[model samples]
Target chain A: MRNQHQNGTNHQVRHYQALSPAQINRFGLVELGSSGPLYRFCVRLFGILALLGIVGFMMRVASSGFSDRAAWGYYVATVVFIFVTFQAAPTVAFAIRAAKGHWRRPVSRIAELFAVVGVLNLILLLPVLFLIPPITGGRKTFWFELHWLLPFSAPGFFLFFGMLALVVCGLCLLYLSALPDFAAARDAKGGIYTGLARGWVGSQRQWKMLKSGLNLLGAFYLMTFVLVTTLFAWDVSETLVPGWKDAIYPAFHSITGLQGAIASTILALGIARKFGGLKNHLHMEQFWGLSKPLLATSLLWFYMGWSTFLTYWYGRTLAEQHVLQLLMFGPYFTVFVMSFLLKFLIPLLFLIWNRVRMSIMGPVLIALSILTGDIFEMVRLYVGPFTITEVGHEMTHVPAAHLPDFADILIIAGAISGAIFIYLVSSKIIPRISLWDMKEGMLLTRVQSFHRAEVLVIGKPE
Target chain B: MVDKSILGLFKDPDSTADAVDSLRKAGFGNHTFDILSGVPYPEGTFGEHGPGHKLFVFPLIGAICGFSVALLLTLGTQVSFPMVQGGKPLIAIPPMMVIMYEGTMLGAILFTVLGVLFESRLPRPGVGLYDTRITEGFIGLLVSCPEEKIGAAEQALRGAGAEDIKTESASGGGR
Candidate 1:
């Protein structure tokens, strides 16, 4: 839609024609049903990789039994990497939706779709749970001596249940958010969508309930995400390393998760816009809007990391030094550098620019950088600690960084690919764009002439 | 004097709002009619009464139940065992707080989901006086009325530019 210049001014105003509700519903349903050859090929490719991940996992398990925690360093790192990145992606949906950012309407579904990956991560977490020794082994753990009294292993027990709660909540959030779209498909085609929709009729009461449910679930999902992150950080990484008791570490891990979540969401949005036939729906506004948070999280990542590093640096004791060497300067120095630059330094330097932050590719590129850094960061955090087998209250020695082998590489690539594979399959079932959200956005927004330029007027209802 | 359900479809929101206003003017109370749309127009867009819900109560109740159960499990287990590990008391409040927190959240989340389902009256046996076009940008104003007032309801709906009207018996099939 275009508006002509009429007041003897040479300024041309461009008006956006929002997609009608019917068009949104029809297009979303059609897109869900029909996948291009390229999309199908990608899905198959990822499916093969996912199978390879299973093969890699089995190879590792067979070759090096669960007794050797050192050998499974990369394995645990890969699982945590997935947990913090793809599994954390839904947090962006909850955060943006809770903040009532209208630009998030198109992006929220992209973020929420990543919840399906939580199932895969939950399965990956089980073996890692077994890998963690009980808290009774004279190791310093949050559980103290609870392992002696409890029937099961304390760390593993808590980690498994915490992760399970997060996964279930995430799935519920995704399901509830997609209910309206299912009803749309049911209205259009009347097959399995009917059952999935479960008799949703868009009545006022249903809408009210749906809205309330989303808000509550989103809040719960966010809290559970933080709790789960804390569990992973403390039990898997912190408690594993003797004398590595930094209170800020769990918060640091959460910051990493939040950063990784935004990065993954941005990357997925870019891919969807570029290759997933969503060019018309996702615009530069979404990218620019997300870039602000990406920049903020980058700064927060540096802040948290620096705070932890500073504490260890100032302590200057042998125990603190060993802890620092294990995580930062000792064997995984290269990984720490790479993670620092990509996750914090590089994003900070580039995303600070107005020109870079305003473009579609800029934020996407930064997101890519952050995700690459997340892999290195996870390795540095999880693998280094896994190498230390000492169960004392203080570090006796800082072990060398355990490099990943062929199986570990497969596990890493396969895990990431498996997540993508699950996402692709899910996108087929659920409409990629939130159809109802788009329609509601269209209803709330109007483009009108403000002076010489056409500006959008958005309605914010209480 | 049987009750009948009537659904008046409107292409645009303004007409839907006008239909609501017209129904009220023609002796139909707010409780007798409801608006359905593909999009969630903000409450009161049609000047209809906002329905109250008990959704918030579910989470509160869940939190209380979860906290109570967690307190019992944590305190009961510790006191039953009664071993001081790190120069601490038999019942450690700090460590138990984690489990308690998890229990509280889990309870709240599960009950909130159930609350949504219950309050929404999901999985209804039948969708009465419904039109599929309502999901395709059309708005439906559904009215439940006595058989004697069907003509007046139809007149009010038509006066406000209803695109189409469908009526169904109280027992539930739309035609």
Candidate 2:
């Protein structure tokens, strides 16, 4: 004997009932937190700060009149700056992954904002193109600038614009690929974010359009970043060391850039998680997941740095050997020690400790350490030669100049900060997270009897 | 540290046989405590605790060798063929020192990596009492007890939320 209930007990509830109830969308899931007033405020603050900094830099440059530091300082800063072009791809990869990772849920929006701004800042790099004129202007500084290739007309303009086009193209594609996310942000609220998201709507047609375009653009950007960054590294950085040239320099720059990107994202996430009330949906599980990349890359960065040195030591070239010497004990020893401690030692120790890596403090500390080492890497490349003090001086060698003054650092700091400011503001209007992705995750989740007698979530493919 | 005896809470079936042994000795092996984690931490050599690790020294050796080599190649080589430039000596050692500095750091970090791999017992084909479920987030505890204590141990395991008690035995790597 079977018992049937009016509401279909132990069966489908109200089969073929009137379809009058408001349809609850299980698929459309977006993060609950809104940037609110803080989003707009931060954007405005960053723009104000950046403009102020640029103005200050102009004032300093006017007062100083090319009296910043020695030739070595200029050379090193230029080398590191140029090498950054190669790093762009890896940096983008890092930013994307960090933003997408689950642990980054708390402050993922801010990270996306941070990355977009970083991409835009590449435009500000237009001024760096100015460096070419002085070198290629047929003017000699201690030695006539090497014109191994172009002996007739100045090719500086051509080289600069050609590289600029490639970078701009790559950046444009990357930005376009992020459009769907921006659309999601735009629809989030009626204020700033919605304004940025402007035309993006969550429709099948729109998604298809975004996915196809993004896939095509992502591949182009990836390839372009690889090619252009390598070219930039070779032409700009390696030559600064006189005889110090390595096949790995291009790869090294790229990998370091990736490391930098990873670190930057981690730092941004840390800042967001704390300042923004993000701990609710963003759980501890997410933090560990994001950490795995940082750990893996830190090791890779470690490997890249080591292999370059190992090969140089073995090859024993006059130029290579001297370049190594200038870094080790000659003039850059203190900086070397600092880099070692920050880059390898501290990170290794922290990563090995499971407790530390799992903790909130780990990401912050490691990011700071990497930043310090990054600065040191630049100094070693350019500063060591100039800063070396001749100990047993019997007229055998000349003492190079000291490290770069506060003025040079200030310039870079200001420029980078300005770039960061732009990112902060843009994010207020942009949907930093991919709404389509969030909705997809929602669709794949279901409540089920996970075991014999317990309820748990079963993840299904969308 | 949590005692291996409480492994019941962590849920190991083989420990049941051991619990019987403990029961015969008039002991329930209540020294057992549960591991707070999402994966099982297996136990080995019932009477003897596994060896504790010391990785601190590995990086030290690496750092020493690294700095030492960095000094020799850059500074030492400069003495050998110091390229004299702009009225400088034949062995212009300072510029070469830059290479040494980067080299030293590189060497130390490489050694540190080698040291970490060595200390962690990593890349094991098959390692101590493990269940794939642990990776998917299950905290297993390995209990040690005498045979006679089996019933109480099983009850205790269930009371502490043992998903299931499994007989965990180590199989050699090749197996």
Write candidate 2's Cα lDDT for A1-462 as tens digits.
Answer: 111223313111111111100111111113323455766677667666666656655655676543332332543343354334222433444344334432232333343344344344445444433333233322211112223334321223333433443444444443444444443333333344334433432222233333333333343344444544554454434443455556786676666666665666566656655654443334444445556666776787678778888987898766566667676555677877787778667777787777867766786778778776867766765554433322221113323436554555555555555666755555434434433334333333332432332222324321
Off by over 4 Å in 2: A1-52, A63-112, A118-120, A132-201, A315-318, A382-401, A452-462, B1-175
Q: Candidate 1 lDDT, tens digit per residue, A202-254?
A: 98989999989999999988898899899989888898888888989899999
Best by lDDT: 1
Best candidate, DockQ-wise? 1
**Looking at model 1 chain B, which ten-residue stretch has the lowest summed lDDT?**
B166-175
> Per-prediction TM-score, please?
0.96, 0.55
Ten contiguous residues minimizing lDDT sum, candidate 1 chain A: A6-15
In Å, residue A351's CA in model 2 sits off its true spot by 1.1
TM-score, structure 2 vs. true: 0.55
